[model samples]
Target: MSVILESKSSRVCINEKGAEVCSFVLKETNLEYIWQADETYWARHAPVLFPFVGKLKGDSYTYNNESYTMNQHGFARDMVFIVEHQEKDSATFLLKSSEETLKNYPFHFELRLIYRLVDNDLTIAYQVETQSEEMYFGIGGHPAFNIPLVKGTNFNDYYLHFAPSKSRFLLPLEGAFINLAEKTLAQTNTSIQVERRIFEKDALVLETKGENAFSILSDVTNHGVVVSYDNLPYVGIWSPFPKEAPFVCIEPWAGIADTTDATGKIEDKKGMNLIHPGDVFERSYKISIK
Candidate 1:
């Protein structure tokens, strides 16, 4: 089922399949800023990443003394979410651990996704509560916005503008996990041009020791999206087959992929957030389209 929300200026569709956004349209311009999930390039629109952000080293992890294999981004995105609340401009979907999930994650928890639309801004909030012992997990957002937001515009015409112009480190992936070495990213101060060659290596995972927000702006269109991540330590920018794909993803993550130096223990993976029994983990990111 698809839940719809509307504001005076825009509207969006959220599918229950993964609690993912399928479409976002600006009412005035009739413009679609969110990707349409064209299978030729990429098939997902905006997927919520939970428990794990990226790939686990060796596609497995050890918890306590048992080894479990989990696919990239965990299983939350593949499960159906129940609608807990709905209003004209907001909706909340929820997913709780079950026997099926415990088989792999072994944690009892509830994950809530609340999406609220106000004017041209959309706020997506995540809440995770633990019902068992300490739980180690990660959560994130993978929202792909359409490039060349305006017709006749070129992808290179757009760029990511970072405020305060600070130098940051990029952690490149070797075999799907972080490399031991760090590379300089956006060293030119601010505004990194969006080009295909930039992603020839892979997604640029900005080390989150500094700045936590960024804006996607186009010199030609003079309009774009601003993403503000509250308390998220990692941000990822990616586009599949950058040359052919027509979308770019701005991701905010509370966790990260297993590092090259990981020991495969779930408790020791870098960037994992821990929640004690009866405790709740809350985080959010906002997308403002201009």
Candidate 2:
């Protein structure tokens, strides 16, 4: 099932499954910003990564001396979420830990995805609460926007503008795991062109030193998107490998994949967030249509 939220300038559609945003369209030009799932390239629209982000060592992790297996990006994106609250321009979907989730993520917790649409912007907030003495997890956003945004423009015409011009470093992935060898992605440049070759090595996992924000802009048209996050340490830019897909994903992650020599323990996983009982963990990112 899906819920529709409308503002004066835009309309957004979100599905109960995955609490994913299926569409974001501007009323003025009627242009769709959110990528429409195309199986020929990629099948998901916007999937929320939770409990873990990216790939894990051996696709499994050990917690409390027992082993539990999970696939890439964890299981939240494939699970159905209950609509806990709704309004004209906002909605909250809730997912609670159950027997099935506990089998792989042995913890009692509640995950809430709250989406609010205002004017030409959409803000997504992730909230996690644990009933157990302690809980370890990661959460992130994978919202792909349609490239070329305008009909006459080509994908190559768009570029990503990173804020606060300075040198940026990327943690390159070694076979789906972090290699830990930081490489300079950009030097004193505020923008990078959109191209298929950039993603040939998988997602560009970056560490931005200042305000975490970026914008997709095109030389031919004024239509684009600006994505800004609050307190997310890492940002990822990706598109399907070697596919020349019609969209690009801007991701904000609280945790990253395991290092190549990781010990396979959930607690030991790099970048994972931990929360104790009676505490709530919250993070949010915003998408503003241009």
- Alpha-carbon deviation at 95 in model 1, angstroms: 0.3
Candidate 2: residue 167 lDDT (0-100): 67
lDDT of 2 by residue, 84-176 (tens): 999999999999999999989999999999999999999999999999989999999999999979888999999998776666778898879
Cα displacement (Å) at residue 226, model 2 = 0.9
Worst 10 residues of 2 by lDDT: 181-190
Assess the local accuracy of residue 220 in candidate 1 as a C-alpha lDDT between 0 and 100.
Answer: 83
Tens-place lDDT per residue, model 1, 165-190, is: 68777878776788756555746357
The local distance difference test score of each candidate is 0.87, 0.91
Which residue runs does candidate 1 get wrong by more than 4 Å? 183-188, 209-211
What are the models' TM-scores? 0.96, 0.97
